[model samples]
Target: MKTALQMSLAAAASLSVFTATAAHAHVSVSGPAFAGATHEATFGVGHGCDGADTYRVKVQIPAGVTSVRPLDSTFGKAVLEKNAEGNVTAVVWTKPLADVLPADTNYYKLALRFKVPDAPFTTLYFPTTQTCRSEAGVETTVAWSDTSGEHGSHDADAGTPATSPAPSLFILPARSPGWNKYTVNQHVHDLSVFNDALIVWAGKAAYSANPATQSLITTEPDTEVLSEIHPGTEIWVKY
Candidate 1:
């Protein structure tokens, strides 16, 4: 009773539903977006290789980031990386958790200290990974990709079978937190610790939204800056 295109869109929509049900498939960052503000970036875990327990995470801080630090927890460890320019630096840090990734739940948190730049516009990238103790804690890398500036594309699950082309995940844009201050809280969700920003790509422009709205925020960036948030550049996680 439906045309091929209609059936295809229906399938795509179905896949999106399936992915949301498996919300813990990837690790992400979220929180408020004010400079010198510390927020919690939550790393989610679900449906990965069976027996795979998320152990360590590495977050790459983009240029123009300031006052970056990880919170101390049962699974907290981190370090800072200074840039060649000296003024700019990326926070290359990792942490160990008390609990491993649960079989059917999202678990993890990280306390992060971050200051937005002076500029009104900028991009932040976060490249992260999860390790399973079974492989001597072999790190399973989680790649970051963003639509150039397009909005609302990641309507499907990462593990779902594709019947059509998938919408790309795009990194959002953020503004500098000049003199303003925000607070970071530590809480356990599902089974993982999370402490970071939630970056949302709503449309042509990217903006960091509150992680609480992760369900509403879109991850598709515009097509122009397709590779701007490439996996290797470090994922600047902000919500």
Candidate 2:
């Protein structure tokens, strides 16, 4: 007889397979808040380079979400640039002089402030970009994380860019009154022959419902591909 856990695992695996095949690149929005609450949101990025690729990122926010601007970023320097709309501006990160980020450095932080107006706060969506560059300054991989973990966090695997059996997650909460902290994860993968990497295409995400733990549901996505990532590549971008 199959054990109860085994049966459950099989079901979850089947669901994951379905999601992986149908996955697409998209952004996820999560929110429902009052006018005075501070809102914190964390964006997740998965996949990084070993010594081969350097990454630069830019996050764009919707209009009028908050009057507050982004403070100094932990990952790098941020500058306010006028958006296409002309009057509105968004925060953009300035890349360092270094052509390539050191192999050991794999994470960055971007903190923003959201000051709500007298009106009620509703849903806000942030669209972002990831630029991957090679030593020759050629572009490599660019990806974004949308889904939230139970609390809204994602793990990025640097260098490899291969999908694991585990599902990745990121979170965006509704508006609140004070400043909130959003933590993001970057997974480093060594896509070099010395590091040994597997190329894979990411599929869609699928979820499993569990009654025991209302919030502790299961999710799975499929990433399958075959090709070695080019060496000396990094990502760069500005919102």
Candidate 3:
């Protein structure tokens, strides 16, 4: 029989997986989440709204993101909507010659390239709106604007609605030469492979002495800090 502690740990792990799956259960954006980098943001449209065929999609550009340009798609014609300041605020893609395509065949995937802001350790949410037109000339709109709380507080049990949900990306800090950020689920042996790299956990930093060892040590060489880190730990390393 499993102990009480083991049972509780297993339940928590299961909940974590469920929550992550639920968060990405809508139209999502994919790209490099590095700060101040030029990247292609691909917006994936899984299906049409309800039973109607999606004819148009509009993605709101976040304030700090600039130089927005949508890529041409064979499924639709891309249009850029600019504000009075001449900054592109939104990019809309609409099916070309709607009458030519069958109502059931109106689906699309859109992409745009832009420069991410210089903000690090921040999350960016892009709210999207999808417009669908039924065979009877009826129009339906679905908005993907739901967001987490101000400080990135996520509600695991929050039920997702029929409408789309916003897609988000986390921006990381700029790294020095040979340094990179990695998310790990378990222990990472061979810390010495990366010279002068530090392990950061919960805002605390630790270093290792014998780089060839399988574990990391605290600032004090006599004290050992960790051999295996907690799951879902994000660490910055030079390797």
Listed per model in order, the count of residue pairs whose N, CA or C atoms clash below 3 Å is 54, 46, 1
Candidate 3 segments exceeding 4 Å error: 1-25, 97-107, 149-164, 176-236
lDDT score, candidate 3, position 135: 76
**Candidate 3 local lDDT, 43-160, one digit each (tens):** 8877776677787888899899998889988758789999999999999988754543335554456889998998654557788888887877788898888764321222231233
Better of 2 and 3 by lDDT: 3
Candidate 2 deviant stretches above 4 angstroms: 1-34, 40-46, 49-54, 83-87, 102-105, 116-122, 141-239
**Tens-digit per-residue lDDT, 139-183, candidate 1:** 464433332321122222323433322122122233332212222
lDDT of 2 by residue, 1-239 (tens): 12442355344433332111101222222232234556443333343444443456666655565554665655567677665666335566645647456442454445566654333211233555666665666665444433222211122233233222211222222222222322212221221111110111122211123221112222221322212222232321000
Model 1 per-residue lDDT at 226: 18
Each model's lDDT: 0.36, 0.36, 0.59
- Candidate 3 has a TM-score of 0.63
Best by lDDT: 3
Candidate 1 lDDT (Cα, 0 to 1): 0.36
